[model samples]
Target: MKRLSLLLAGALLLQLQASEPSVFGAGNLDSDSPYGLTESEKKIVENRQNLKNTKRKSQENSAQLQSLRERIDGLQTIIEGLAEKTQENKLKVTELTSGEDIGAQRDAKIAALEEAVRADEANIASLKSLLESMATQVDAINANYVSKDEFNALVGEINAFKRDLGKTLKSVSAPAAGASLESKSSKELAAEAKASYNKLYFKDAIPMYEELIRRNYKPAYAHFMIGEMWHYRKEWSKALSYFKESAARSSKTSFMPTLMLHSAECMMHTGDSANAKKFLRSLIAKYPASGEAAEAERLLNTL
Candidate 1:
């Protein structure tokens, strides 16, 4: 029984030794960086080189991921503020000593605010899931390594403040019905729209801009122009909605500084001071040399 046990132990030891993790790979190589290598050793060396390359790439990915995390943190902060405001709405509801109509209006407003908060939270969750998938895209979801294409795409999505003015937007929509705009070339419509806008005939300019948006001719600028008209009208909600669409498309336009300023004002009027401050600060940081940045700095102090 003792001799049988000894033989079993020797076999177990050999099996354990065979399963050890190393690049040397079933070889008699003395060290990892040996002087001369066989074909198998050469293969191992190549693998090591590839791993070194992956590590370098991993470092770069880590930097991008860090930036992503900071942005996520900022978003989470905004969400928290929204949540706090929603709670305050409940208190306001309880303290409503006003008429039923007033109470109903307050309730409706609170409900809208709550719904917007829910949508924002859902968006944040989706973004987090996308990042997780991005991390897992390569070979068993290795956190350390990400493909360059995936990384670049994720960066583009997360880095909202990034400007790419030269990028042509290809987002075409069904044309809004307009005989004159429909007949006119895109260039002609753009020229006419700008002239009307400059003349402060914003009401006249709007349909032309909407036509441009539908035609996919500078849709971002079109959206911004429509938002600007709304801003002039002091219709904050409608302006904000279009501003968001404009930013979603192309945030790199020459008019972007004004868009940021107006967006910040819209948020402020809507009782979203935290987000308004964020927008103002981002504008100041990104367009520091611009006149809009000068305005943003003054606005930031007031915030």
Candidate 2:
């Protein structure tokens, strides 16, 4: 038992010597034990180092994800701003196009109106020329045929016929209350006569005007118009007679200055220079600011 005990103690001392390092800073005493650790302890240290590397990698991945999210948010905001700007551009384009269309329409309307005004002016000029031609043709026709005495007789017969018609119309259609039959008839006759004269229907116009004169209504103007017709025919003696009568009855009318001028021209045509000069001087004295006064001054100088 003492020898067995001694063998066990020797085994224990060898184990302790193998576990401890030398005090001279030498390596492990036992060559079979690497780094003086057991196999299980080395395995545990390798597992702990592996866990730390995995944690560091995970933290880096998280930071990268946060940066990507911020970049995506900035890009989205930029896209939204671009969309708003595009809409504003579309509205501006629409307004400009609408204004251009309205201006084009307005210009077209103005052009059409101007064209119509030009057409109306042309039509009025054509009518005036046609009227003047008709007047000349009537004067030529009258001078070619119809003696003065026969024409006068025809006018008298027409006047008689008109008087008979007037009486019949008065009986057929009575005048309304407060209406003057005679005045209305005279006005109607005057309008018809003037219209006939304007249309160059002298044969129809003369008798109607004469009838009005016979009724003692607006006789001065009728006489003056008759004198104008005779003057157009170069009947100097008849023109002078009518002109004198017009002047006599034109005291309350606006036709006196014109009638006086006509009378002066008639006297000159009849080779009465002395009377022409005296009449022209009288016109100048009475109506110095009139167009007739200017003509009289020129004629008197020539005489």
lDDT of 2 by residue, 22-73 (tens): 5444333234443545567567556666766754554343344334323322
In candidate 2, list every pair of residues with a backbone clash.
none
Candidate maximizing lDDT? 1
Reference-based TM-score, model 1: 0.41
Residue 80 shift from truth in candidate 1, angstroms: 45
Q: Which run of 10 residues does model 1 get worst, by summed lDDT?
A: 164-173
TM-score winner among the candidates? 1
lDDT of each: 0.67, 0.59
lDDT of 1: 0.67
**Model 2 CA lDDT for position 10:** 100
The TM-score measured for candidate 2 stands at: 0.39
